[model samples]
Target chain A: MGILEVKDVGKRFGGLQALGDVNLSVKENTCHAIIGPNGAGKSTLLNCLVGKLIPDTGSVMFDGQSVLGRSPHEINQMGISRVFQTPEIFGDLTVMENMMIPLFAKRDGSYRLHAIKSVMNERQLREEAEQMLEEVNMLDKRHMHSASMSRGDKRRLEMAMCLIQRPKLLLLDEPTAGMARADTNNTIDLLKEIKEKRDITIAIIEHDMHVVFSLADRITVLAQGTPLVEDAPENIKGHPKVQEAYLGEAH
Target chain B: MFGLDKKDSTLLILVAVLTLLAPFILNPFPSDSGLAQFNAGYPDLMQRFVIFGIFAIGFNILFGLTGYLSFGHAAFLGVGSYSAVWMFKLLSMNILPAIILSVIISGLFALVIGFVSLRRSGIYFSILTLAFAQMSFALAYSVLTPITNGETGLQIALDDPRIFGGAVAADGSIPVTNLFGLEMRSAFDMAVGPWSFTFSAGYYVCAIVMLIAFYLAIRIFRSPFGMMLRAIKSNQTRMNYTGLNPKPYTLAAFVISGMYAGLAGGLMASMDPLAGAERMQWTASGEVVLMTILGGAGTLIGPVLGAGAIKYMENIFSKINDNVLHGWFAFLPDGMEDAVVWILHPFVGKGWHLTLGIIFMLVVIFLPGGLVEGGQRIARAFKGKKAKETSEKATTEPAE
Candidate 1:
């Protein structure tokens, strides 16, 4: 059995079926990428995984547990973290402060009462946030407001935010979308580094073939609300169905 | 522009000093003058300053942090006042039970409102709150009149049984509230350079409460829960996807803010022994919003500034009439005086609201962040440190 599994998941939005019967399994600590055309329901599938949307049919299982009916935070507590398509770091807070949020939640597993004295200054949480910031190469800019950062820096801060939660599974919804080519390459390197250093199972939805090829251990091609194929990246690059559905159409 | 690291303690110290000397400073105006008529240093006015400050501070928590614009907050305040008045009527004038009951009842009202309202986000949520508030107001005005006393408002009467400890007289006039037998109205007055500086016991009580409220606000602003509330404001979807249910946090904020309004209402009743239905009007709700915006919405100090500024203007403006307007321009030639009066009469005399309307429009248009931004711009213009640092940071950073 795989660490995370999707069994015959289907979702409908009004009269439109956003996702057909889709099945996939991700092995432990592997980087998986989902790619599809604009109308292919890739985002819908990602939302289903992160508890943003519930599937109309089938089940999503993480670490042998059903995640279908759980709230996002409950799912997160069960070791899943999501990074949105747009960089969604708290703009008013500093980079370090943003990182501290997930870290605090991870350590305490509760949003503390506003009336209570804060527990964020706990030594372990502070040290962990600092380590995560340094890993993301954002230690120096830690005090700067997250909103004031450039687009690439914002993504990096968000990455730090998600990673600091220390989730068993991390979901990225187009982490490199709208990024410059250089920034995309940096992100690829960052992912590669994270994969080597942390015991995290990552499922990323991306349009960038270069980013997918650089980081993904497994690739899933989606077309018309169904999985066209799931294979290793090398095999996916040459698959006939993937070519017709995505690659050939792209070129 | 005023960097958080600015070490000038003098400004804060000066403001503190001014507050300390307000009684003497405020006494210089002629007692009958328009400005003097609304002098907040007077027992009634001073009480209002602190009480409304509490109301606005609580409001800032919800509107400032969460970006939820609640149009019916006055209902909570009114409910609190009514509850407190009932405590005086049914129990005794002992303020502890009244204040406690006020908070609990207001919070319960807010909980019901928040639970339903939070189901929908954004403008829908705002409308939901407004609906609930209006419903509460309507009920209070009509259906619940038996309890609320309807348009006449709820008041303590001589027939009220003094079950709890309070200042009751043999003749049965409504008793003054006393804390452990010490009257809140007990005063300490000193003569200072041709003026009597009076620091009434009630003023001290209000000040202590205000300080505690301020400290609590500051603490909440710095907390993780505060961070989550802000996150909800900025991006609710993002917060949800990150494993947070924004509903609980927002609801908590709504209830907390409601309690603040309740406390303000309770204090108002305590200061004076009557509760009015008019206090629950939409206009009173709008006044708090105006205060929050005018001061500076998000900043800790902003709401207080907003409340004080608006209240000060209301006092000064409402007192001016055509006669007062003419008195100011009496030395001018007839034609010029008449022209000045013609220009100012509509806005200042009976039309003080016109002046307030224009000011509100100007602030909303030019200073969307309110007086906080205005203060920042002024500070930035004075120091130029803000500009220099940003340009330097820009130039020094390497391209990613």
Candidate 2:
């Protein structure tokens, strides 16, 4: 059984079917990629898994617990971390401060009124955050404001933030969607390093086939809200339906 | 020193020194001098300065940290005052219970209001709070007349049961608000040459309370909870996706600020022993907003500085009448003096708000971070100038 199981999930936005009978299972300790053409429900399926949307027809199970009705934060606490396409980060906070937030969430659950206790007094969290920053190659920029950093660094920090939680399921919604070739290469390398080093199950929705073929152990191709092919990455590379619908348009 | 880092410790000490010697510092002008009108050492005004300072400090925690703009905070202030006045009537004339009751009641009031208003964010949230405050003002003015005393306001009565103390003094007057046996209005007068200062018991009481409030604010500003609030302000989406609920945090901030406002209201009642519906008016809520933004919303000392500045201007400029102007411009030609006074009329007296408005506008336009940013810029400029001079001296010495 996979860590995440989406059973025939279907969703509608008004009259249009945004996601239609989407079935996806992301197994533990494997990098799974969901690649699709425009309006193919890649993001719709990701949203359903993260509890941003309630699938009208199906159940989303993360290790047997339903994430359908739960709020995004609750689902996050349930060991699912989402990295947004635009790199959502606390821009007003410093890099180190941004790093400490997830650590605090992981330790303190959803909410803890640690009002009087100084953030600087959290020596353990501070050290862990520093270590995470080091791992992401952002330790030198720890004191810099997260907003003022380069886009690449912000993405790195965001990834590090997600990684620090050690979430059971890491959902990346276009991690390198708008990156330059060099930055995209760096990100792919980072993902490769993370996959090799950690026991994390990643479920990424991407349009970049190079990124998909490089890291994905399993690839699911979707066309018009339905999975066209669910196979190993090596098999997905040669799949005629995926080549005709998605890979044909990109390159 | 008090669990604060060195920088925060220094700031607390500086504020402590300033407030402790406010009488001496504020009364720079001698009593006999014409500039004595500018002196803010009197008990009434000093009490107001500290009380409003406390209010602004609390308001800053929500608006400054979490970026939640609430426009109904004055309702809490009003509620606090009414509860305190009620406490004085039903329980005791002592200020402690009244202040405590004010904080508690206001916190409860804020909880309800914040819960409702925090459902929306940005301008919608602002409107919600404003609507709640207006509703509160309307209720306090008309519907809640029996409890609030309508337009005349709630006042301590001679017939009421002061369960902890006497209802009326032996002299046939209601006892004033006191701290134990010490009266809020009592003061020690000191005269040296032409200089004189009145250190009122009420001013000190208000000052001590404000100091505690300010210290607590500093602590909150440095805490993990504070960081979370800032994070929410930065990006609510990120905070949610990161598994932190922003709603409860914001509600806590709103409630805390409301309690602070309540404490201020209680202190106001402790100083005067009256509660009025006007205290909860929308304009009163706006004044605290102005104070927080004017002082520098996010900075620790900004709100207090803003409160003091606004109160000082209100007192000093409003007191500058035609007689005072005429005295100053006596040497000018009659026509010129009249023209000068006429030209300055719109910026002084009842029109002092125009001057404050202009200053606030300038501060907002030029220093978006508020007065704290202005101070930082000035400090940086001075440092830059000094560094240039030192560099010039080094070059000139080598040339010589």
- Identify the leading candidate in terms of DockQ: 2
Interface RMSD, all models, one decimal each?
Answer: 3.6, 0.6
Query: What local lDDT does model 1 show for residue A154?
Result: 92
True contacts kept of each: 0.40, 0.84
lDDT, model 2, position B24: 92
lDDT of residue A12 for candidate 2: 94
Estimate, for each residue in A1-251, the C-alpha lDDT of model 1 and write its tens digit: 78899999999989999999999898999998999999899999988887879999999999989998888888888888888888887887778778777776676564555554453445677788888888888899988988899999999888888888788988999999999999998999998998999999999999989999989999999999999998999999889988988888868
lDDT of 1 by residue, B323-383 (tens): 8778789999999998998898888755878888888888889998888889988897867
Residue A152, candidate 1: how far off, in angstroms? 1.1
Q: Where does candidate 1 stray beyond 4 Å? A: B1-20, B28-39, B165-172, B185-194, B385-400
Each prediction's Cα RMSD? 4.7, 1.2
Each model's TM-score, in the order given?
A: 0.91, 0.98
Query: Candidate 2 clashing pairs?
Result: none
